[model samples]
Target: MSVMIYPQGRTLSFVYGDERILVCREDRPKVTSRVQIKVYPDGRVVAAAPSDIDDHAVLVAVKKRARWIHQQLRDFRQQYEHLIPRQYISGESHLYLGKQYMLKVIESEDHTPQVKLLRGSLEVSVRQRHSGNVKTLLAEWYKDKARDVFARRLDAMLEHTLWVSERPQFRTRVMQTRWGSCSPKGCLTLNPYLVKASRECIDYVLLHELCHLAEHNHSERFYRLMNQIMPGWQSVKEKLDGMAHRLLLN
Candidate 1:
């Protein structure tokens, strides 16, 4: 599909194999025209073409660089091993409420594995001492915590937010990119991964989405609403974004 990105330029989305690349035409002045391709952590590719170059030429350039792009993406996924194939082993650090805690695995006759926080560590009890998916235990615990925390925070914050006739419904989910999203039907979904974030960051995300319930877009008015409700949100958002690389529960 094509999008009218500028007055005289357009952007295209190209799919090679299973990967979708965003071809962007950027206006550059006082510099040599060039095509620069970048891959984000979320596995999205952005190909920046010179403004003067038309969409047809940009497609040609992207095709020529497809081999390099594929290689780079492969290397990136290899480097970001933390984002996948989580090893449920002892001594690895995990984040909870913005604090790092070591994992301590304990085996017992009780078959059902349970996770608990004690002495700045995640004490996980498992039935099979030899092998089993302990990651499931931790993930289940985090999901429950995410639901509880988001509900309580949203309840307290909704009172200070803008107009609403009915109370919004809340749910927890595992999302790849966004931390949370608000539906038009007053249903707010939060990322279960947020269980690892600080209390302040959690509040910021919930309030940000709550503001969206009123404004629905990040316009000046939306930001004004955010400022009026929660002043120090941008900083907390930045901090939360920074945790994406380190706080992976895959």
Candidate 2:
């Protein structure tokens, strides 16, 4: 797992029965006494605690809520039947722009491997009919589409926020647990699988990264800015979160 530590805090772990839970601890200056514990869909437990709180206290707090965390993780895992591993073969369902398309694999030796969306189906023309080639072609196709879509969405989102004057450098990446990340240098790395989500979901992620251009951290002021700009972001986020399992299936 990638190490995610805040500037003011370090990573910590606690034993919950037999399972060891790793916590990404963040020491927020604005946090007074309450420790905010959030369990993400990726099963990462993030604790935003006061700067004065020590490692032991954080551990205790996480241990106290271990059962709840397990329940949340269980719910996330069992909520979707389609969460099973994707076979990437003909007749399998694939998602693009929040729409489901059946996979139609064709073995054609005369042409190079290519992926195309045609008549409610994702058609793959490959020289060899195998899972690996189909997977790679689909990934490349998604990456290509994401580049165009994200660029257009980014330009459109910039008009909504005045904080970003120029378009930032952005690239597509396949991440295990995150949809996107903005570097300290303002470069954006987005998950290629994000294209499987809807336009509003894509905009939410782009605007979220753009918000970081103004507010570097997830502070109260940053959320306030988000609320002002996207009033229904929380609802949008929930919809995206609900689709994470199916979207992130390998």
Per-model TM-score on C-alpha atoms: 0.67, 0.76
Which residue pairs in candidate 2 have backbone atoms (N, alpha carbon, C) closer than 3 angstroms, thus clashing? none
Question: Model 2: residues >4 Å from true position, as ranges?
Answer: 1-9, 26-42, 48-61, 72-84, 110-112, 183-185, 238-245
lDDT of 1 at 184: 77
Q: Number of clashing residue pairs in every model? A: 0, 0
After superposition, the stretches of candidate 1 with alpha carbons farther than 4 Å from their true spots are 1-85, 130-132
**lDDT string, candidate 2, 1-250, tens digits:** 1112121247788876677877888765453677777776666677778767788898888888889987886775675443557788899999999999999999989988998899899999999988999999998899999999999999989899997888899998887667888888889888888999999999988888888888888767777778888988868876786667668776
- CA RMSD, predictions in order: 7.6, 4.3
Best by lDDT: 2
Candidate 1 lDDT by residue in tens digits, 1-250: 1111111235666677897766544443313557765554545555565456777776787888887777777887887775545466788788888898898888888656788989889989988754355788888888998888888888888788747666799888787656788887768888888878888888888887877777785555676877888887757755665556555546
Q: Which pairs clash in the backbone of model 1?
A: none
Q: Give the Å shift of residue 76 in candidate 1.
A: 10
Model 1 residue 248 CA deviation (Å) reads 3.4
Q: List lDDT for all candidates, in order.
A: 0.70, 0.80
RMSD of model 2, in Å? 4.3
